[model samples]
Target chain A: MIFTIVVVGGVIGAIFFIKPVPKYYTRYGVELGTNVQITYATSKGNAKQVVDEMFKKFSDYEEIFDPWLVGSELYNLNHSDGKWTKVSPVLLTVIKDSIDFSKLTDGKFDPTVGRLIPLWGFNTDNTRNWHLPSPKEIKDALKHVGYQNVEIRGDEVRLLNGVWLDLNGMMEGYIAQMLVEMAKKNDPNSTGFVDIGGTIGIIGPKNGNEPWIVGIQDPRGNPNQAIAYVKLYSGYVGTSGDYERYIIVDGKRYYHIFDPKTGYSNDYLESVTTVSTRSIYSDGFGVFSMVAGEKAMKEMAQKIGVAYYAINENGQVIKSANWNEYEYKK
Target chain B: MNTKNKFFSKWDLLLIVFLVAGLGIWIGIKQFSPPAAKAVILLDGKVYKVIPLDKNAYYKIYRGDTYLMTVETKPGAIRATYSTNWIFPQTETTQVSVATGWISKEGETIISVPNKIVIYTEGSKERTLYDAMTYQN
Candidate 1:
């Protein structure tokens, strides 16, 4: 009888150790005018339902953030005609964050270039609809392009001198952080990531312990290719490249990322990838680096305490010394 | 000797063997025989179809009677041939999806944002080097 009891106890302990690993599930969708891919592992077996709710949240936020969409909160704010209009919490928060980032980058990355987006005919997705605007047109749009023109009092915001705002610089990172938060809220033990366009946020470590390896695309290479890779266990990684949207004219490539001062795309860098503890920094730093060039990029990275990797227009790769912390060498 | 004082009896030994064998089988199936490579296509956040990457074929995709694009699949890779956007019908597209070329790796994806379509491969024999990729938006 004693021997039997010992055997039974041992068998029970073995069974506890043999619990199955959580299965990984990846779901894809389109939201915020970009592709959304989420991969998660949940031991509770509610992964599908949790992901469905996450997509629903993405769709809801897309309309609120889309600057070009008619009837959107941002659209109403842009067309407010210099009057202080009460804004939604989401819009107010983004605008506040935009201003803060603008100050941080010293206007290198500005969201008030909304007028230039259409002036260069880049407001539409169709490449055929895009064209090089006349010098006068760009000059006129630059007249209304300055982050300082935005005024916020309590919950009300007014665009001075008809300066429109475009939050694409930091929108993806903001949404990615929200999705990761939702994932952890649903299941605290969950491990996964949310990728909106190219901005990625970690819900948790891969398989609850391992880092999620992320690849940075080669700016001049094919879309499916990667020039380098990074290991991320938490936080976010964002890349800004000139190849994403561009037009070639007179043997010169002009992209969509506009310089607030020049009213033309910045061409100093081909790509800029940043890793930050905050998603907004991860997303916005690349935009800052693109317009600011290498010297300013180095200063900004040190000041903001973020890691970065960049390839210049001449195909020279540069990285902050701290980037060594996240490099994934295979 | 009394049987009660023994560390293990014949039945106890047999039970241990049965338990160990069951655990071994479970691990083998879970680790060794992973599913074959296949492409998962989504339309407007829904699972439109799943096509195994074992043969050469072209799959035409549509949304509510509107023809969108055609996906070409070969033995180990897949790509979108062409896509049309109704919103800018007259304007030529950048053909970003078609420009992506063949995606044979497990984690690579092809996306047509205007059409609300996404395609990604899974279950390759070799694990993907990266879980996700970053690019300029």
Candidate 2:
């Protein structure tokens, strides 16, 4: 009788706790930006429809596939040429948010490094290419990269100079936020996750139960590995890496995550991943912390009220004072 | 047909109705549900399929060409690489490996093997590992 009770109890536990087996799942896919796929799954009525509408409402491609058009318009506005051109509310909003990040990081987080891409030949496909920028060139770029250059009035915007804005740092995070908002609309009691360009956002736990497990990507792309897994309950995460962009030559390494001051990559750290309530903060600070290094990161984490985990150039792990609070499976 | 054998009481009718409805949904899910999102992993000058089994079921895994793994997916996790003899894994190569949850001192994914790494990208196939290199732009 005791053995029977044990077997029955075990069966009941599995039935009640484990994710339902042989359960039905539906997925919807939509491509945005450099090709992002948002998948929505539920075994209920019209799961795919909800995801489809969500995609329609949110996209960072700036109207269409024409990057050059968006780039030129945004650059003209962000630079000293904002006195002209009709600025979209979307661009204005993102610029404002980026400005807030720059202030929060004390200029450590900047968005004006747009031309850096073309300079490195990332604008088009040319593998055998890379040109190091001189300090003077970097200084010139810096003049155009500050957040203050972007001025926004009631409904208009003004650019301080010929500055260009690169929203790549926060674009993914913004998409993630939109996904979470969409998920909440369908079921007041549901679990959802969205990842756009490595920026991950979540809406509650999985299936109205259990926390969502999010893995932080290793900047080095070592393979079959993860730096950390933090259980998320409606929050944001972002990663910046020295390994994010680089060039190899004669067995040497050079990356593109540049410093506004040096006109070259920040060397103090290797990778920085941050988690916070806001995706902008997470994404911006993730890059900010990498450029700022460990000492500055301690202060950055406190300033933003978030948790951070970073890897140094020599392979060292350092977390902000509050990192333990958010680490789930560490 | 025999009348008595074919006839059903109200209680029996209710039970059958419930069972049929429940089973219909279950079977429908098994039958008409859309195919899993496909991702073409570019690695070693070839494309491999990555079936991301995201526990949350809402994360879509993308490769070089299209979707690599669907969200809310729970595919089997790879604790370790299952390859015996391997080949060269270069910058644009791709591979499908599970999160052993293993990390390095620098906290990057450590794929000790060549075939274990795959890159996912856009336009150019193998998006995942394709852009892994650190381009100090």
Candidate 3:
């Protein structure tokens, strides 16, 4: 009786004295043409204020990055008529980064497909506006879609030929990383995440210790269901799939992520997810993989040292060797 | 001195019995009396409305006079049935949210990004397995 009493009393004491979990504050909304969620718990106060500030950054950056938005920096640059136009530091940084990625992937993830986007009617938010372009139209747009045509001297950028720049591929991850940097600067011990669209950047580890488990959405499954899970203690994860912003005509799906050479959405893969230490790679690799197919994806992963998990057109799961490190099997 | 008397007097025995009974009752209440789940709807990142998923009902979401979406709720589950873009109501752009069907689990969400609407559940006993999710942008 004494032993039982002691044991029960000790158990009750332990349960009562266990460390309390931190309360996480979450904010969700639409920004940068997609859903944005910011969740965090900080030892320092003013978490809500900081999160609102982060959301404001999205609209500010969208004005510069969104090519379709009239009077946006990119819009003005696109219509500069071959003259050197001075660009903002942020715009110049992303443009230079995009050019490097284009060279790295051998034009697999070119940002100069701005002409092709509007031709396919994907430049607008309303799906009613989306339509299949004729073969002649595609051919015409492909002529003006080349990353090498962009000439940058100093802080000024010049578009050669009729090429236009679309920075959508890496813009979300860049913004997410910027938000993460802000969180870290405000509080080093902050624990939270910044999700811009589907690309995610960890502000810090979960509760300052555990890895945050992130689910990867199934390409052909329900919106809330996840086909796989990844454990992210830090860094970023992003997915590019053919499911969103797609229009089906005669059972043929014409989605956004266009191929520069062919000026059509590639049918190589259904979805490609990448986990990387760099924000740009997390966002860009999926676009690169979607266009380049499986063999090129393997080669690109090797060259860039990023982990990828992909589902092919036939619904086969393929992943890189390093992907196992971040994959949560359960 | 008797061993039983020395170890636990009548008062000690009664104290032990009281504590055990209290602990059992606490555990029973925790295990059996689960709280009702609630669905939180947000418009533009602000709380628009909150509905308890304890009855069958429909909620029409509108921004001022412009109808945006309709939310359906049953006992312990909620879903978006008909959602349209505020700008282009005639043309059904994408039915991803409506096609998502019912989301009953806590942390499950149905999002209409163009409409700037989000609906998610909370206070369910079965928590979501993952902390976050990644999908096509």
| lDDT top scorer | 3
Q: Candidate 3 residues A1-330, lDDT tens each?
A: 565577678889999997656678888888777888899888787888888888888778988998998999999999888899999998998899999999988898999999988886788776667788899999988889999999989999999998999998998888889899999999998989999888999998887788898999999888888999999999999999998777776677678898888999888999999999999998899998888899999998999989999999999999999988999977
Q: Could you give the TM-score of chain B for each candidate, in order?
A: 0.68, 0.28, 0.84
Across residues A140-200, which tens digit of lDDT does each residue of candidate 1 receive?
9999999999999999999999999999998899889888988888888899999999899
Q: Residue by residue across A1-330, what tens digits does model 2's lDDT show?
A: 343455558879999998762222323232432223344555554656776666666434444122335454464454445574556666666667887888777777777677665666444322334445566766766666766776777667676676667776776677668677767777655556665545667665565565556666665654334567666666877677755345644445556665766656666887777778997776787778767778888876776698877888888888887777667664
Full-model lDDT, candidate 1: 0.86
Better of 1 and 3 by lDDT: 3
- Candidate 3 local lDDT, B39-92, one digit each (tens): 999987789999998999999999989899999999889999888753233333
lDDT of 2 at A6: 56
* Candidates, ranked, TM-score: 3, 1, 2
Pitting candidate 1 against candidate 3, the one with the higher TM-score is: 3
**Each prediction's Cα lDDT score?**
0.86, 0.55, 0.87
Q: How big is the positional error of residue A305 in model 1, measured in Å on the Cα after superposition?
A: 0.8
Would you give the TM-score of chain B in model 2? 0.28
Single out the weakest 10-residue window by summed lDDT for candidate 1 chain A: A120-129
Q: What DockQ results do all the predictions give, each relative to the true complex?
A: 0.46, 0.06, 0.54
Q: Least accurate stretch of 10 residues (summed lDDT) in model 3 chain B?
A: B85-94
